[model samples]
Target: MKFGTMFTDILASFFKKNSTQLYPFEKNPTPERFRGNLYYDPAKCTGCCLCVKDCPSKAIELVTIDRAAKRFVLKYHMDRCVYCGQCALNCRFKCMGMSNKDWEHAALNKEEFLVYYGKEEDVREMLENISKPPAESEHK
Candidate 1:
């Protein structure tokens, strides 16, 4: 090969070898359109259990705790979830939205995979919003 051709090849090889991801050391931000996680709006959810009933994968479950308080604990099995968007679509509360927060959901214990949003303060905003009249629920 010519000297110029050899030099170009060497540079290309060097650059290719150096191209690597620094993952743990450097975190990357997700794009706005990126679908990472399914976040429940707590306020929009009426505990109708539509999502749980319609979920094909059976990954979602709504458990009633305080009947008089209109309280429900929604549990999601990350392992069984296929990210199909069906659960969000079937949701009557309009409380479910896709977020761009992608963190590893793996754990040695199977119970750890189940996520819940049951805190009183955490659901306060959502509950108040859901309790409002239809006309009052216009703007988010």
Candidate 2:
């Protein structure tokens, strides 16, 4: 009886369509509202930290490069992200949102997860400022 059941199951499987997808070559379509990864637009950003404050995983970090100039850098850690879409909802400037097109975020190293979003000049200035000591007047 056991041998007959096993043989019948194998015969049935041969007539059925393949359930597994040929990933990497033939990809499956993602849903319309699928929250794949966070995307940041520096031009649309108002330097507001609402996204950072609302993130449940604390994956978003806003670094103020210049208060007067309203320059900021958005540090988005993909590894720590929960993809809840709260950040996009909380952002009043409409700078942050999720992109459904590119969801492949696999990384071999932890350092690859860290994404800095900002203007070229702003990022350069921020890096330069970080390397220098605070001025005496600013320290006061």
Q: Cα miss at 1, model 1 (Å)?
A: 12
Q: lDDT tens digits, residues 1-140, model 2?
A: 69999999999999999998888888888888989888888767777688888889999898887756767788889999989999998888888789888789778899999888888888887778789987779554
Q: Determine which window of 10 residues in candidate 1 has minimal summed lDDT.
A: 118-127
Candidate 1 clashing pairs?
Answer: 43-126
Best by lDDT: 2
Give residue 96's error in model 1 in angstroms. 1.4
Global lDDT of model 2: 0.85
- Tens digit of lDDT per residue, candidate 1, span 1-140? 89999999998897685565687776667777665567776545678788888878998877666545656667778778877777787776688766777645657898887777666653565557568877855567
TM-score of 1: 0.65
Q: What root-mean-square deviation over C-alphas does model 1 reach?
A: 12.3
Whole-model lDDT per candidate: 0.72, 0.85
The TM-scores of all predictions, comma-separated, are: 0.65, 0.78
| C-alpha positional error of residue 18 in candidate 1 after TM-score superposition, expressed in Å | 3.6
Clashes of each: 1, 0
